[model samples]
Target: MASGLFALLDDIAAIAKVAAASVDDIGTMAVSSLDDTAAAAAKAAGVLVDDAAVAPRYVVGFSADREIPIVAKIARGSLKNKLLFLLPGALTLSYLLPVVITPLLMAGGAFLCFEGAEKLWEKLTPQDESADEDAAMDPATRERTMVSGAIRTDMILSAEIMAIALGTVEQEPIAEQAGALLVVALGITALVYGAVALIVKADDFGVFLARKRNGAVAALGRGLVIGMPTFLILLGWVGLLAMLWVGGHIIIDGLAKFGIGLPSDLLHAATEGVAGAGSLVAWLVEAGSAGLFGIAVGGIIAAALHAIPRKGH
Candidate 1:
């Protein structure tokens, strides 16, 4: 009996040792996955910034009290779009249709170019403002419609973000790809809406501080009040540039993969040399070249589409 009891204790000890090893293995995998997630998210930085920049426009006409609520609604919709809709589709493409991913990414890149160029086109050739459809609706109704519209718009951007993110991890195991995309979707959604919440409420916060506080605090409030509009305009310009550079790079790089290498050659040549700070210069030149390429491609696309005559107006 004594010998048997000792044998049972030995067995328990061995099991515990195996369990500890398994736990360590899992911990290592988790860390590696997180690193990949960060790198993948970085590749989509352009869309992420534009998402943040474009979100503010949705809240512009709402009452102060409604701003955060509207942002919250859009945030919820964006999450649903990423996690429920785009995530599975992205994973499916990576697993089953891996070959199509590059062409799809280029399509998205072209879209970004078109969007960026269209914005420039609008700026250069102003059209008479159409009356807003929501003008006749009650405030509550208008808010509902606006929230729905914003969500629809967010669906497009969220799809792009997910596609760009998944493209980065296409070679990883399916589980790892899922892990990276999950992190990106959750992280970016939080980042974008959190920033939007802060932006929409800055003026109110400033007003509160300006009225209810004094001295340095009050001066800070005044500064926020004065700075928010300028900050927003600057943000719009930044978003445009980001779209152009990122979109252009995607197009030229994709073309290189298909044996159309001239644009890619230009991109490479623009950044081919570097010594010390020249690396920084190389990065900028590469980005600038991509942006210019985007302008050319996007301008052609924009003009071609514009030439299509409008009907039934």
Candidate 2:
């Protein structure tokens, strides 16, 4: 009886030890996974910045009261796009049809370039008088239109973000890749929409503070109210540039994958050939080259569209 009891106690101890080790392993893996995801997400900073810069414009022209809710709606749509549609599709493609990834990425990148170029063209041209009339006519319709447009745009940007992330972690096990992508998707969506919420509301917050009795508070409020428009205009320009650069970068990278490596090689040699050039200079050169390439492609597409006679015209 004594021997049996001792044996039983030993078995329990071994089991506990095994459980502890298992727990430690799981904890270590979780930490490593998060770190990897963060690193991968960081690599896609250009797209992230463009995402942030483009989001606030959707809330423009809305009443102060509707800003936050509109942002929230867009945020929810963004989350759905990333998680529900893009995530599974990305994983499936990465696993099953890996060869197709590059072309698809280039396609999406071209769409982004086209969008950015169209916006630029609009900025250069005068707005139609009917645009003002439409804005004054139906608030609900305008809000829905803006929200739909934003979400559609978000889908393309989200696809790029996820594809870049997947490329970074392609060597990992599928499970780990899924976990990391989930973290990235949730994290980026929250960060982008949260920042946008704050941006759209800053003017209102400024007005509130401006109405306060404290001098400093009022001054700060006034500053925010005055600064936001200029800041937004600057942000718009940044967003446009980001779209061009990131889109061009994607296409250049994709071209290399498809046995056409000259562009990438030339870009590298041109940048690296600079004497005493550092990483920053190389990066800037690469980005500039990519942006120029994207602009050229986008310009051709835009001109083609312009050539096609519309129903009204």
Question: Which lDDT values do the candidates have, in the order given?
Answer: 0.76, 0.74
Which is the leading candidate under lDDT?
1
Model 1 misplacement above 4 A: 1-42, 273-277
In angstroms, the error of model 1 at 272 is: 2.9
Candidates in order, TM-scores: namely 0.84, 0.81
Question: What clash pairs does model 2 have?
Answer: none
Report the CA-based lDDT of candidate 1 relative to the real structure: 0.76
Give per-residue lDDT, candidate 1, residue 95. 88
Q: Which ten residues in a row have the lowest lDDT in candidate 2?
A: 1-10
lDDT per residue for candidate 2 within 1-313, as digits (tens), equals: 1122223323322232223234246555444455444433433555666777888888877888899889998999999998899989988987888778778878878877887788788888998766565466588988988899999989878888788767655655666557657766776787678778888888989999999999999999999999999888877777787778877777888889888999789877878786367877876787788888888878888899889999988
